[model samples]
Target: MITTHPFNDDKLREECGVFGVAGAIDAAAMVALGLHALQHRGQEAAGISSFDGTTFHDHKALGLVAGNFDSEEIMRLLKGEWAIGHVRYATTGETALRNVQPLYAELASGGFAIAHNGNISNAVKLRHDLVRSGSIFQSTSDTETIIHLVATSRYRTLLDKFIDALKQVEGAYSLICLTEMGMIACRDPLGIRPLVMGRIGPEDGGTVIFASETVALDIVGAEFVRSVEPGELVVVSGGEIRSHRPFQQKASRPCIFEHVYFSRPDSIVDGSSVYTVRKAIGGQLAIESPVDVDLVIPVPDSGTPAAIGYAQQSGLPFELGIIRSHYVGRTFIQPGDGVRHLGVKLKHNANRPLVTGKKLVLIDDSIVRGTTSLKIVQMMRDAGAAEVHMRIASPPTMHSCFYGVNTPERSKLLAAQKSIEEMRQFIQADSLAFVSINGLYRALGEASREEEAPRYCDACFTGDYPTPLTDLSEREQPNQLMLLAERVGG
Candidate 1:
């Protein structure tokens, strides 16, 4: 057992939510609760903005919605029939209260609200262009760049300005906007982020909601319609759903990671079960990365479903070797090495009786920086597991993600830094194997025939960004964070 915590482990989620009501009266409170259900997508900050049949009201705070929103206070201020709310995890911006979403802006045409999921890879260039034109920005986020772009457009109507604004920016984004006239939602050409249109009810027959995941829809009692097509824009107003597309439509490339790790199991994604996809990934791992072992042990939580699938497919028995303590909230994860050293142990407890002197096959979703995996492997070994064969359900994460996921530097990525044999030696695993890209897609493809329409964006694997970035005039490469910071703060 290797007892070591490797450097550069950052598990950050960039997923967010956009919930709205066009026809309902108590829209703000409803959006508040809807954002709560979608909180798993992001927990750093929460915000809600609404356009009543008359006036717009907004409130955003720098903590989880549960902590920030005092119901009576927010509800008292938020009075409206139409609303849009957001929960965010910082990916392309500084983590500050000002950077939180459902960004409210007063435009020459009228008032509008915007919430964005995914990253604007070309934001640095766009921000520079805006600044050169005397555009002043209030927040340090890629999402804010779009708002500035829209504000500067020469077009007359908000819709015209918005369409022009979409043309100027590049990269993955699913944007939901609350305009004086209606609610507008658009998915990037690549569809790196997920967005679905939801029908509220038969009673409130005309109401519709837009969200990053179907789970938000389920919570709001909205029926899952279909995903907003890549490079498409849909607007809901006057109880009527309308769409516009000044930009030409491009190939649809949805993010495959949504099924791998992000989404809630119960929420349907483009017509497939998230749980089933995970299980299939596990099943594929067993077939592709087989090993002789006494027990198949999951790393707990995300690894459990895949581990079960692996166990069932491999005809090997599965055991709850690492038990996760659900009671530990984010507050329990203390910062700094003094408490950070307890990252793995505080989250999990090893069942020594099951592993004492056993050869265990450990299943995990993927290794980010080798920190958590190294620590967990050492814990298993310390628990008396003589041999630990590490199996990863996804392929090696080599490239950094610009589509709103908080991945570290490529140099820090263990897979990019070390080969399979090198990683096995580094983690001291008896053997280490990862499921192939083909196996991952194959397993997911086999799970449902209905998901064939929209192909997934595996850019993190293949370096194939579906949308061509046009505004990275200053960005020579993705790793130039220092240069980016200088430009932003200058």
Candidate 2:
């Protein structure tokens, strides 16, 4: 049997999603629901670890949540009052059961399990150090690095050891941990990733919830509380929640792409509505680049919201020019060679009647490799469209993201090597325009981005990484290595 990934192949991929709850009667089930709500963030694998006051129970598998955890038998096995779960789309490690998280360990402090979202840039260096110091690693995941750090720390409390573990790492992380002590939720110093807190039940006695997005909270009937502050470590135990900032504070720079593509439309991230922000980005694109088109069409699901805003702002009719098939599986057995060439058409079909003889505007979140864009433009022409113009909601993605997102190398990025005109030619579109960097910031409610110190991580677009790329710096071209080495250390 053969398996194939879903149709759209030109989009950036998110790393993972995490959810944790403390004090819930059915903690594992609640975590399941939260993970389901965040399924879009990661589709490769799912796992949950629960602490039942006396012992830890866990189930991890390599597939969707519905297939793995929906059974009553599976839920029954994960009995506990506190739990943490993770849905993974691997960025730093291979897709295997061992790499699947809520990675658990037995430390001097008792059972510790953690589910993480985002990449640890210094993991390679740290792993090398730990291995050299006689620490044995159970999994290949960088998340396990923290576990080792905690196990070896001389600190008196588990919280202190966890804090010490975090202080030694660099890169983006929004983590939810389960321990005999309690539930610990924390974000990195720069807040490059996102973690939100919520509550359910009566005010006096409620279940504390932590998840990667507000949508997760909504799914579980939890009231959305404030985000876990940058550089803040939150410990929930004994019906009480406490916050601490162990690392030096700095300006928070959450990943801006969450607004562009990663998060669910209904999610509220970093205090902004993702749907509204995406719509605004489309509106901004329309303002900056207007073309005479008969209709505005989205590339389906991801582009729907932005396309609506573009249609509204441009005074053009909105149409479903392309219809997406929801039934396509992650892996399918191809019967013959002839059917393999119809890959894009298998997932998306042009609405011939609506697209015939129309000069259409196609709006998409971002262009990664340009292969999907090329195929879609050809599909529109095949459906008798007079012309197809492309409008991108976010600025061109020029640099690879080392902070969790899976992106092609800089040399492979479409925009990194080609000019705007070249990109239009490559995608075979009549015309193409991307939202300006400043316009994107404006849509996000900022006047303009501060070149000196950006409010968010736009490194993929501007090449201005907020944190040091430790792993990449050591392996980059020799000419550039010297400069980066000096900036980051020897």
Candidate 3:
């Protein structure tokens, strides 16, 4: 039977990707291309919603963008000059098609569709109150909570209604919405998630594109204008665009792991090139934990930049000791349980000749559950490596991410449960060291993580969450909120 690859479960999974284009000819086509570029952020499902003057069209499917949105039939069905798309990994909802987004609704105002990235920590509590007040929900996605809020809001204007909905929610969100008026895009006040605005032509008649990352804009030949400011909303209509800041501005705390793992290497987040920052992180890791090794080797694609930085800083040769198979798309048919046990090698395998008896420094982004790390160390030893010292580019991930990342519970986190030496023993590495939190801050060009107000969100490493976790606090009230969460896929 075909099953999704389980080897990638050891790392944090990004929640979703949002892409939209306004005032563009064949906007749906541009949105499809942009969604393809942001596919790494989400892979389980893809959807597109478009508005053509008087009518709105939508198409959603369970699979990759290439599998769903690449078809001429699907593209032709989504006919419009304004479009928004979403790729989802389902952090707050089930994997069923009913939960797939750019979720659309017919309201008193008109047809409204939304594509959302990030999570709402207070969704469960809000959902309970909404349900009690006669809000019938069709999907379990937290994004649907916003729609219900808009529908029941006392605000007069659609724009005011959107801002009203956002004010009631607590947590990270970057949203792209399609309304009869035009397209609206915004990031949460904390900027815990990412969104950027770009344009394809001259200011007057150009297509305005919004995406979760700059790489999405690049794919559609759009010139990046700027990141959507935290607490700011941008609206496009009739070939015109405007910005509004509805919430009070606070220090932005964009997710730091975006540079380490979530974003594509070519993308830029919060004015920093993801690839450049990753390399700097590797340099920091090397300085913090220098090792006597024959060569520096990256775990695979995600680790390559850091590995290069490590080699450059430590004055060692960088080698591709492990090769990853690009053919392993998302899922493969596994014959039986026994073969499943060896699935790790299907995606990655060591280059036997290069590391045959040589001591190596293995570079990786971070160790999550430690299962992948254990398998990789074992793979190196089996390939005749004399020694394997593992170096992590980021600090130990000791806390679960409650914003947008799909993380295991705190108990499952390797670093949260074990010390550095214990993790070294568990992974069977000769030595294991992670970049210090201060080192990570330095790599990002900060003096250090300020106790008063950090420039970036390092909650995964420091256990200092920027926002309140409402759902967790309501965990004891199973009959009221927690029970509702199970039914709503929170």
Candidate 4:
């Protein structure tokens, strides 16, 4: 079985991505391209569901989109003009075929298939209640909770039922669902997750597309439309589009980390270029914590843009001191602990000639558990670097994220457990610094994080969650939730 390389596993992971297209011929193929563009968000599994008026067809598998959806035979079977797809990393469910999404269900109204891109924080509690009321679940995915909620709602129309289901749950979600009526796209009220809309040319059947990121729309050659507004439900049917705001209006709190690491640098979120925001973040870091070093070096791909910003701001030459191997397959296997420990070079290696005598400033997006940072610093020292100072582009991640990010428990987060100096010691670096919380807000165009109603969700850094964590709150102890989650999954 393919697994994430150890060198790449010590980071917070976005749970999944969703893509949907309506009114296009050969729509499944377009969905495939969109999902492929979104592959970076989630890499464990992928699935697609399509509707061709009278019938619904789907194919789900435990692998990358290219591996599972590139076959002509599979595409031929997913016959429909309305399609939605998902790539998953298993935030709430087991890594099994049944847990793969674009989860399909045959409801009383018709066939319903949904692709979800965030966690339903109250899923376990809702699931327990649903089971006691005789709702038999087919998979452990929290997404299915929405389906069951819709199925049991007494609302008159499918749209009403869908809205009814959403109102009953809490936490971040950006969803794309396909049904007999047409296609529906919506984001939770807080907008902690992202969803955007786009339109294909008339030549391409004038398709309306929705995806977790603008990058996916770009992949399908779809023109950029506005984002699906928070607390708004958009429906495309009868060759016309309709928008609904079924819930009370509230200020949006989109995820701030999207600019730091989760999103592709090429994508745009909340009308700002992610690449530009990251560069600004790096500049903020340079201003807040100036360092005396010979060269500024980025950890690798994710850190490159920020490093450039830091270089421009601090007037230091940015160098690629660490070269990442592009050909290193995600499925690369290490047979044992000894082999795994030696596998760091399989992904990145220091440029010995460039770093032999230089005092370097290393820039990275964030330090999670600090294992990757520690190893990278050690590797640089082994290459004869005179000094290494680490600068983080974002505020220290001191809290766990429950809004669909796959973060370790708070206890395991390096920043949560250690002070900046302590983290420097743990990573064996000469120095370390992170952008202050207010500095992060400044980078994002806000003067400061408004404590009463912050503009974005920075919960992972501040522990200021916007929604009630029903499942976690119900647990009497920290570990009790893990036990309860296992039981709820059953």
Candidate 5:
């Protein structure tokens, strides 16, 4: 089957899930198969690239990997013992075959393939420098910026080139790369993104796995190894793994949102159950923001379990407040924010009787811009509800996220501009309570990385961005791949 299944909006993003394998036959094919297991993180496009010691072969297309790839295609491109794969959501470039990755780059000695998760903070700066140096480009992706640096760097080895490129780029990234000599996986300095390592067994013919989430490893029968630490690099070749830690920055804080929203429930993100963390948030919301409610209403899909937890904590009945339509493709047009900020009507509608005339505490993952929140509240008000108290399972987003999550400029975020009281008045809600910062950590079962779960980077909530983002307020919107490349690839 070309397409394995479907996903939702919260599930769709510029962030992608990556998978790579070393020391195996048909490694490229295996990586492709593993990516299939992670299609939930991204579905707009898929690609796999392999390095067989002499050359790199890649095949990419704009569709679910299952529908876009077949056994015959895998075999035709399979040539290496090291392979890397990507499933993408366009954050930088337009959705097309050219933008699908793992993107390929040629070199004098050999080539490498790369699949990446996260955004480039200093892409504008880097792309400008590269362009001035006469480094021609292909594909309008932030990732190609890394290649331009690698191609021109005077480093003696590809590994060294990778390190140099890492130094030049700043932002959230978890990278899996395949070269003729080895399989390399690394995460950004702050660990703003996640990349874990796993193994099948040395004695069972020795194999290693690298993926954006541990769930993909578990699906393929691999034992969980430690996560590739922020600013650390690992190279696997010939059934052996070697580690590198050349760059160490400030505190290594992986994105907390991964546990709260981005990751799969089954995957252990830095060793925490994504499901457990969210449920705890729900329970806390109930205690901190309880309402004299007839029922606890969840926003649907992502909020279901939290709603259940809220109901349990508040002694209220839990009900599905909004039903999501599955199979809505990414191609669906999200109504523009200005003309119809209340885009929720297109994606959701209220079941009036369940909530009408009832004192209801409505729960949702978050309120990014508050436009949707305004609409949702209006919907509840229109449904004959006596009161609508909005409780977000996560903290207010006051900062723009450089790691992804489609956050707009800082000013566009309602939380950034308004006080808590102002937000309630603007949204026309009776009340609003967000999960406390410390409480949020506890909900994720806050534990040390060595103990179990790790600390997380909540830059968007705290304004302590893991890395600095270049100011782009003056830059015009980029179209096609060139715009993204020029803006972020430099």
Candidate 6:
């Protein structure tokens, strides 16, 4: 079986990251740097597509950005004034080279290439109709559906055809498309995903950038201008930027998970610092579920900021009871089952001196399968911990995400299948508590979740999906993997 990072298996995985720059010299190099910064969003594959006035050049490979694009030879092949790049984790298709993105196609008007950062919920349905009408797809990726839609649209102009194509699709998307004319960036009507605009130099003569996170902008020395408004399309043509509203306007509900886990801590999303929000979540968790302990320890990396807040708020001494090995790759060639069982240890190990005979509190962002948590708790006990209590920064995730997040089926989620006490027992922790839903909203600086209209997409916790699951509703028995596979093969 292909496994992800051993330590990250229990956390929700984001689909991808997108970066695009127009009107810049050596645009492909800048995109390479930006994608390197956004690599945490996806590590399985990386691709870059560039448009010099007439032709489009692209290079995609199945590996980390550094492994693929670090060579000057590869960079030389992708020369252009405008470029777009993508890092993918395969939300809708199999992990194949053909599915790697910046899916390109030749249209009646011109050549176009697009990099997307979300899932198309209605792709299966729309793909079936398109195949019936004789549209031959080159790749099994749902992103290819957009290209076909644009190719077959009756609209005259490329912009009109692009807008018409988007009008036919449903689900969350933050897209950056490269064309012979210019680059176009747009967010889904509901803004369930994130995209931001930035400038590298002055407005009169500068590079226009679009990225999934602001950290990408920072890496490329760009100043973030603003988030691309929900349902708004931004076009960068002839060294000028313009905005258009192509979809019917609706209340935007950006994905809350961006702040909880998907984004880099240093990145700013929707005018808020992800690190600050995570710390606030930790403080709120401490307020709602305080525990008396000798030391507060974080699970590492993702849980660090929240752990800091938890320690400060609870007035407990913070210590590194667990240390992570940064060298572990996502997948390793294990020789035997015995070696596979040691996966968690390969990524993280308990600090015996700090944990021995100490009552410790383990702070983590969220728990999904409970297997990792169970193993970590057992490791603590083996290290001679007197007691181990687990506190989660986010509310229990009881539902699967369909908006570009890779999640196990609802049945596989520990929170969905078990009660709080049942979870505590399963993980063998002395105590286990998750921050309440209202408390999470409070940490985000909201009074509470608006029962009728949520400010953010909290469907994984509350099961109140902001958009209709049309494809799921149509199926008699929905099989997520089967549906996605069929859409691809069809």
> Which stretches in model 1 have alpha-carbon errors above 4 Å?
1-12, 203-205, 332-339, 446-454, 469-490
Q: Which stretches in model 3 have alpha-carbon errors above 4 Å?
A: 335-337, 473-490
Task: Judge candidate 3 against the unseen true structure and give its global Cα lDDT, from 0 to 1.
Answer: 0.91
RMSD in order of candidates: 5.8, 2.3, 4.4, 4.3, 6.5, 4.4
Q: Which pairs of residues clash in candidate 6, taking residues 3 or more apart in a chain or in different chains? A: none
User: Which residue pairs show backbone clashes in model 2?
Assistant: none
Residue pairs with backbone atoms closer than 3 Å in model 3 (clashes): none
Which residue runs of candidate 4 sit more than 4 Å off their true CA positions?
Answer: 2-5, 202-205, 473-490
For 386-446, candidate 6 gives per-residue lDDT tens digits of: 9999999899998888899998878789998899999999999999999999998898899
lDDT of 4 by residue, 1-490 (tens): 6566476666889999999999889899999999999999988899999999989999999878988998999999999899999999878888889899998888777788999999999999999999999999999999999999999999978888999999999998999999999999999998989999999886334789999999998888999989999999999988878999999898999999999999999999999999999999999999999999999999899999999999999999999999999877678766778778778887889999999999999999999999999999999999999999999999899878889998888778888779999999999999999999999999889999898889999989987778877877422236445534655694
Cα lDDT computed for each candidate against the true fold: 0.80, 0.91, 0.91, 0.90, 0.77, 0.91
Q: Evaluate model 2: give its TM-score.
A: 0.96
Worst 10 residues of 1 by lDDT: 1-10
How well does candidate 6 match the true structure in TM-score terms?
0.96
- Tens-digit lDDT string for candidate 5 (317-356): 8887666666455454434556444445656788876777
Clashing pairs in 4: none
Q: How would you encode candidate 1's per-residue C-alpha lDDT over 126-207 as one tens digit per residue?
A: 8988999999999998888999988999999999899899888888889899999999999987677888988877633567
Worst window of 10 by summed lDDT in candidate 3: 474-483
Clashes of each: 0, 0, 0, 0, 8, 0
lDDT of 3 by residue, 1-490 (tens): 4647478977889999999999877999999999999999999999999999899999999889997877898889898899999999978878989999999988887888999999998999999999999999999999999999999999988989999999999999999999999999999999999999999889998889999999999999999999999999999987778899999888889999998999999999999999999999999988989999999999998999999999999999999999999988777777789887688898899999999999999999999999999999999999999999999988999877889898877778899889999999999999999998888888889988897789888888876678877887333334334335654698
For model 5 the local lDDT of residue 14 reads 41
lDDT of 1 at 313: 97
